[model samples]
Target: MATASHPHEHRTDGLVVTSWFAPGRINLIGEHTDYNDGFVLPFALAVGCTATVSQAAQDWSVRSAQEPEPVVVRRSGLAGADAVPEWTRYVLGALWLLTDRGIDVPPLEVTVDSDVPTGAGLSSSAALVCSVVRAVGDHLGLDLDDDAVFALTRDVENDAVGAPTGGMDQLVSLRGEAGHVLLCDMRSHDTRPVPLDLAGHGLSVLVADTRAPHKHSDGEYGARRRGCEEAARILGVPALRDVSGEGLADALGRLDDDELRRYVRHVVTEDERVLAVARLLDEGRLPDIGQALTASHRSMRDDFRITVPEVDTAVDALLSAGALGARMTGGGFGGCVIGLLPEGDVEAAGDAVRRAFADAGFGEPSLFTASAEAGARRV
Candidate 1:
């Protein structure tokens, strides 16, 4: 967890407001492996959300700069079944979780502002819930550690918000550090900070948002999760991650359904791919990890069957433009693609993706560079 400082406050209508920040995250590799108890490498983004919370005189009210209306609901109305705005549910869900846990949550007015692009598979929902949770904890002087925060935030999304997400987003958002990538082990719930000095290695990670928002409630994401669970049961393993690389062939042979076979293959191979990247980073061979990245993307495209045309096109364009490695990041179907390139080749890579999208009649992508950054904290 990042060190906390004295929260600066300003009065609005005689109520003091304090702000808390939490970052969105991008997985460098290992997509969809989180719930399967596999490995993942992700880093916190400098872009995140902030919640400015102040005690309310009446019912709890919440608003966001991105939304046109404010949500007003009483404590009794926050049963996770109220007709709250889709975005405001993240804030309300956090409050609901606290109250359900027997924590006396006072009514508060929360105003949210964020730069993290929503639905671009960047974990914006986690940032929203985490930032508000931090603000609430700080306001009440609660002594919750990182693990406690992770459980609260994750449960808020999964149970309260009905997102069915894994622990990767909330954990990485709370534990990420500057100049490092988090190596997350789902089974043990352990994380290690691996050094990632992109500039020092003369490389840059170019993130291009496909602008095709990937919604968690779309049923496609849930369907994939169910498929993995069924496959694990068929293989008699606790989860797909329990199937070793050496045992993968035999495990796949055991599954009669082709879809289950494909799902198991992707999870097991992706876990190995994550470990391979971690080793290269540990050995200070940053550039050598490119092959593993490209291979991970291919597995997602083929076995997982999650890549859309836009993401696939972006990856091909990035590779053709001299990127060391390029792959779609975040949950599949539609989201962002990250290209690892030499510093000088960054501009060309962006241009290549833009031209490819134009020629293919796809929407223009949003491009930016990302580096490791600090996690959630009061600001």
Candidate 2:
């Protein structure tokens, strides 16, 4: 663990600075499966968030380009814990969770710079939270394991920030590996590493940010989670993981409401797709995984109702441009679409997506090629 030095260690014109990085994450497979205690395959993206921290000499102060008032917070005093605003809650919650876990770390000044687009479903919040946690953990020398770190970060988001998020983001940020897609079992907290060698197949992953913001505070996200839990309760299972895709037909027969039926279909089918993708990757068949990705987008769009027009259009554009497969990534309802394209088609695929968004009157989307990157650690 690395710790920030005393004020004398660095020159501060009222700002103490210790820089840290947290990579964004993309789910290669496993859409909406985390809450189901099912499997997910994710890899860290090249784009991520970076933060600079320094002792405030009074408390914790956060300043960002989008914020006013510097978003000041006291290290020892937290006012309006429940009503804390979105952006600030991530930083504050990290400190609170760390402290509650017996990590004696001092907080001061903080500033953030990020390439991970906020609300683009690139795990920007998780990147920010993980960076804060890593910075504080390094400073305190707590030597907390990755699991412990993820637990604290997840708690901060779910309990403190009041976002009913699953643990995929935190886990990926903490344990990701370069050039490897992590097959994560959320229930058992186990990870099986698979090499992401798509380049050899002449394919690249193109991410198109729809610029649509996903506000986790919305009840829709929570409602979906409740649906999953309710379905599990009705089935006498701990989670949807206990229900196989083959058994989903019977499960749907049991559900009277159309909404619950749709939700169950998404979870069950998505879980199966995740396993299928994992197998394809294991067998060194990258191209075949495209079908799984495309199927995931359809389920998310129609069944889960998490996809918006921007996301759908992005996927449509990519597929129209010779992409093997495309789907909306992240928590949906906006964010980014990922396309698997042949190496020669990357530029054309990106151009098609941009053209589609423009034709749809949406803002020009950001496009990038992402590779699996290492998770959180000191530079």
TM-score of each: 0.96, 0.92
- Residue 83's lDDT in candidate 1: 73
Candidate 1 segments whose C-alpha is farther than 4 A from its true place:
1-14, 77-80
lDDT by candidate, in order shown: 0.88, 0.83
Check candidate 2 and list the clashing pairs: 2-138, 3-139, 16-54, 18-53, 56-108, 306-333
Question: Candidate 1 versus the native: TM-score?
Answer: 0.96
C-alpha positional error of residue 188 in candidate 2 after TM-score superposition, expressed in Å: 1.3
For model 1 the local lDDT of residue 342 reads 96
Please write out the lDDT profile of model 2 over residues 38-109, one tens digit for every residue: 989999987777766666667677777556668766564334465456788887787766556565647567
Candidate 2: residue 245 Cα off by (Å) = 1.9
- In the range 1-379, model 1's lDDT, one tens digit per residue, is 1123435565556667788899999899999999999999999999999998888878789989998889888875347545777777788887877777787778788999899998798999988988988887776667898778888888888877788888898888889899899999988779999989898899999999999779887798899999999999998989999999999999988999999999999999999999999999999999998998899999999999999999999999999999889899988899999999999999989999999999999998999999999888878
Q: Against the true structure, candidate 2 has what lDDT? A: 0.83
Instruction: Report the lDDT of model 1 for residue 169.
Output: 89
